[model samples]
Target: MPTLRRTHPADLPPVQRRELWAWAGYDFANSGYTTVVITAVFNAYFVRVVADGADWATFAWTLALSLSYLLVAVTAPALGAWADLRARKKFLLAITTAVCVAGTAALAACGPGSVALAIALVVVTNAAFGTGENVIAAFLPELASEDGMGRLSGYGWGFGYVGGLLILGVCLWWIMAGAAAFGVDASAVVPQTMLITAAAFLLAALPTLLVLRERARPQPARSGLWRTSFARLRQALLESEGLIDLRRFLLCIVCYQAGVMTVITIAAIFTEQALGFSTTESIVLIMVVNVTAAVGALVFGLVQDRLGHRPTLAITLVAWLAAIGLFWFAEDRRLVWVAANVAGLALGASQSAGRALVGYLCPARREAEVFGLWGLAVKLSSVIGPLAFGAVSWASGGDYRIAMLATSLFFVAGLAILATVDVPRGRAAARVADAAIG
Candidate 1:
């Protein structure tokens, strides 16, 4: 019988281990924003308070997310290509991180009925968050070998869930403890929580900037940024025969990610509105979900290396379909908790598997550019999913259950498309493309 050996920090050279921790630290840092601002806290606040229960709050909130993702969809590939050309992934990451932090902090000023200001800030912050996600993910190919990519990506995602858990825990405490802790009125809780989230992001993200070195060799100067970016984008889209499988995989990601993004963006809002959960209850529920998600990422990440990326992803999508079905019919709040945990498991598995597969399929020399395409797929899903949900919710007069049912179609379609991907063939293409570039 053959025994399997697990990789650990001690198994890596000191420098690579340090880089791994740093890379994971950024996940930890940015997850606070995703948890507190985008997924759990702010979305609920925006709908329930900022927009004051208007029928259009869901629409407006989803629309803001759509706009932000639209911006990322348009510019992520260009910016990623330019960053790769310049070997400036870290630089771009820093700039986007700053934008997110500043925008989140500025949300502190948005008092009651400040819907316009809140939306604008969310757009700016979310766009920066999406851009930064692409840049950081492009580093995965540089950091881990194909055999280790799933575990490494899972580690980062697991760490991210811990970050979300910690930050959400704090926010929950603050919200539950009430005005005495922060010396502010009850109404100020959301703004104060936003400030805490921003500070957490800034402080936790420092290790990445300080420790993760860019390893890519810069190519000689190309045509100007715009020309080169557009040319590269066109080539990646239309000219790279090796990327055909990768392109198909990305299309699969587009379909399922729409469902995933919709769930992430609106789960808290759904719990609040559909189940009559209070602010505190929603925060607590999300914190629990984060815990399960972290466990799922770590467990499935290890499983992915053995089972292969495609199988792992397919399994998760099936889980997603089931979870969404539960959400659609879950009249009792306890059932929502069950659905939340199911979603948590699927969320972690899908994210870790997808990123690892992309790392496996990306050519060595074009990590940023290829991952930019990955980002474009993700951002496009972000746009389409939220907009679809928002539109449905609006048309149905905020019938979130119907919106959730609609989301499951995306998962089913994605799973169907994903079945056709040839993982080994995709990997071979990536290697061939790398050799040609070399």
Candidate 2:
């Protein structure tokens, strides 16, 4: 609902390159939680070991994961609103990072079938991760010049992918050795992984704190920031029709990203179930994908900058459709290997480009709030893909193929909506200020 004012790059307020990198730095740290703990190691542990003996236990854990994301989806927009009004982007990021770290560290205490503890820690950690990402997302425009936005975002994704891969590799080694040499319990492996992940988060966040500089502009000081944010959110919802570019973008994101989310959430499950890969094998496969995705992020980031965000996004959507089709038709072990490579290349590109596109459309003053709404789309999609997959799986007596096919529809639909979105006028924020004064 809010409109962005334009400015000139040369006249824009000063921001150092190190500061930009630092703003992007959190990705390096938080991604480990995503890669090593949540997606690769922890999720597998929960299904394979923690809930191994009980069907009901697995069901309950699944339900809890869904509910946790639902809570995040509900709260994220308002949190973003508060960030925008209060100008607490950095502070909010710190708080969310701490929450993620603390939650991850607590996983060290969880034993097999410690379902309640596992669920609680995961929920807190995931919510923190989601919220922190939104705060960091708002910092993008602050970090880079208008010309640099795409590249900087891409660099962040590339760095994040590398960071995640590094940690996943370390965890995988320990997991394999622990299981093989000592008859080690899965609980022991998980706790150590959690500690390492938590530590990485804290370490990764330091560069951002030390280097990223955000000169907060003045806003009318509101007595109730949260309440005001909620009111603004309501206004945004009501004015949705006028935000044609943003609205179209959101619709496309919902469809395309649902498929992307489905693939990300299910990659490990797919590899294990369909290809008969072991935990180590699956983790290795994911590591390969993520590491490659970092490279893809960097490449696409450059491409987006050169050609503009929308064209690059269309390229990614096409790649996604092809990837899904490839995955669907994959049969031989060799083909599965090829599919992993394809997924790795496009996964991070989609996210980096999507986030940059949002940055372009969002009003400067309301950047954080808009990013929060974006987060809601993403987290809600996380819930949808899993639930849809679960339902289809259940109906088909555990056949996952149909669910995957359904996911591809999202790509096609997303591509359609994305095609309709025209890029907003590219003008620096500082120029607008100078013009007003003149």
Best by TM-score: 1
Give the Cα RMSD of candidate 2. Answer: 4.0
Instruction: Name the TM-score of candidate 2.
Output: 0.91
Model 2: lowest-lDDT 10 consecutive positions: 1-10
How many clashes does each candidate structure show, in the order listed?
0, 7
Q: CA lDDT, every prediction?
A: 0.87, 0.77
- Stretches off by above 4 angstroms in model 2 are 1-13, 179-188, 221-224, 240-242, 425-438
Q: What is the lDDT of residue 138 in candidate 2?
A: 87
Off by over 4 Å in 1: 1-15, 180-185
Q: Which residue pairs come into collision in candidate 1?
A: none
Q: How much is the lDDT of residue 154 in candidate 1?
A: 94
Q: On residues 298-338, what C-alpha lDDT tens digit does candidate 2 reach at each position?
A: 99988887888999988888888777778778877788778
Candidate 1 weakest lDDT stretch, 10 residues:
1-10
